[model samples]
Target: MSKKHKSEHHEEHADESWLIPYADLLTLLLALFIVLFAMSTTDSKKFEEMSKAFNIAFNSGSGVLDNTTIVTTGEQMSKERENNRQPSKEDLTKEQLQAAMKQEQEDLEKLKKQIDNYIKTAGLTTQLETKLNQSQLMITISDNALFPSGSAQIKPEARSLALTIATMLNKYPGYEIVVSGHTDNEPISTAEFESNWDLSSSRAIRFMDILLSSKKLDPKLFSAIGYGEYRPVDSNANALGRSKNRRVEVSIIRKFTDPDKSQNIPATPK
Candidate 1:
């Protein structure tokens, strides 16, 4: 009986039998993970094949990186460079034209003095006023000096102003010339003109005609405009303002200098 008890104790102390199946399950799980890891490390062709196969089997899109398509580094960089390109041909041309126009404005200061000197020497300072602006050398003549109060016919004395102006303008044949007419806010009614617009335009045309008929000037380089009472240099609320507004302006188209100019040179007549 004691020997039978010892056998039973030995059998009870033996390693538990459940360890066999538990070890087998662990081995199978480890093998499965290893296989999956191996599959994930495939080349492009194999990866595509697997992706398509999975998508078909699962009834879904390709099962790789969601919806992203991987691209080479060079290809990505080339695409980025293309997208960052600037200024089309037309845009560049427009920019160049605008730059040229702005350059012309810088040279107008000197041109004004030339006009002023002509005014002083020709004894036209009182009748033809000198004004310097960013883009024009305006020689303004009062209506009383150029014409009667309500007429476009220029006075005989006004010919001196036009003749000297034509001489100066002839020196710079490339400069564009504009004769513009301005007026006060007061209404006008005449046989030749019904409103300020007609009067202003007629005056501009008359002045342009005088300049064109000059033997020294180039008619091709001139034009005329009529800004009736709108573009005033000052408010039209007082007598001085009204008188200022009622004048004719002859503008010499400005020229450009170097972009780096720090000071103005004297207005030299060519």
Candidate 2:
């Protein structure tokens, strides 16, 4: 009877070890829900603290969630993507303008070199000069090189030189060309020209006409201006300085310029 009673008590309390592991599973599931709830909130500092505690409880600091990036909402992800997107149209246009300006500068430099080489080869260095600046490329020719003393007409021999210049200029089209004439302060009253202004104006017009003779050169892009004795490059008190003042300038104006560099250049009178 005593042995029978002991066997029944053992059967009644059989396999209680399974309940220990079941309780541990329930506790792990509850911890997982708590971690999920914390992540759903915007309190990052608390989430980090909770993550650390969980690491210590489950993985001893080395865990799958270690070094995890903070969870972000859909809108936040979209905003981040927009911030890292490609350049805008305005940015592309600015880059294109910079590239175009660089190309134009190179073209102008090459044209200047070619003209300089021609002047050297022709032994006309004293009568001709080329200068490239921020605004334009100026080719200056002495008045004596193209005309008789106090005359508006270009010499027959100078026609060939003008033709060559026109040929060179034809290689670079679509640029605004200004043919400006300047004279000494010496007063002039001739049968054909009433004043220095008349002479200078006629001279500029005649030279520009020759430049326009080239079919390849656009007449619409050319202009003639005469400053008379006003825009002298040197003092008019001496004969040599007066001679230097009598000249014609062919200026090829730039279409585009770098704003930063253009600001440093002094404004030259037209």
Candidate 3:
């Protein structure tokens, strides 16, 4: 009877082996909680090392925290996005330059229209002409309008015209202005002038001086050039053509131009 009681007691202490795995599961849960707490306070490098150690001890590098990335600040994320999307410095400068060129072109067109209207209203179309080219807005005045034959002196009546032009020019500043003189092939040897070169040069200087008389016009921005019989628009063989060839030109030079467009006038004439 005692032996029968011992066998029953042994049977009553049944399935104690299952506690081993249950304890292991609880241990793993505790370890996972610990890993989460450490990750919250630690940097990415140390967290990665700890994660690796835990993974090796538990699941051979395939643990729950295997692919987690470090959290970043809002500023860092914004900077990354900006780096991906922002234009380069060169591209920004090119866009700005293109816009400036476009604005310059528009301003030149407006100025040309104003000068043209003035010329028409003053009945000076035959003696004055305005042309808008890629390089400049050129105002051409016949020599007979500004000067007498064989003379570099400006006509007294033309002083008012020059003053009006200078007033109009004062509307736009910081532009380089060139007053160029052209002459026919007629030879001139006067007391005040030596050759066509001297006559043309003096005429240009005289007209430029009138323009500079306006205090608003910058003297440094103005220049005078004389193309004596070398750059003629008409033939010296005829009276009308020679009259047309003798002229003075005022050019408001462009500060900016489109690179893709063709230049209508030489920027610097040889």
lDDT of 3 by residue, 1-270 (tens): 999999998898768899876765765665576568557843465566556555653664243334332123324444665787744325557678667667777777778888889899999999999988888899999999999888888899999989989989998887999999999998988788889999898999999999999999999999999999999897889999999999999999988766576854232222
User: Runs in model 2 with CA error above 4 Å?
Assistant: 1-92, 262-270
- For candidate 2, the 10 contiguous residues with the lowest summed lDDT are 61-70
Q: For residue 241, what is the lDDT in candidate 1?
A: 87
Per-residue lDDT over 1-270 for candidate 2, one digit per residue giving the tens place of the 0 to 100 score: 999999988898667799866765655565576578768867576677656555554644333233243234334545756887754335557677677667778888889989999899999999999999888999999999999998988999888888998999889887899999999999999899888899898999999999889999998999999999999999999999999999999999987776666442333233
Candidate 1's clash total is 0
lDDT of each: 0.69, 0.81, 0.80
Show the lowest summed lDDT stretch of 10 residues, model 3: 65-74
- Which order, best to worst by lDDT? 2, 3, 1
Model 2, CA-based lDDT: 0.81
Model 3 CA lDDT for position 19: 82
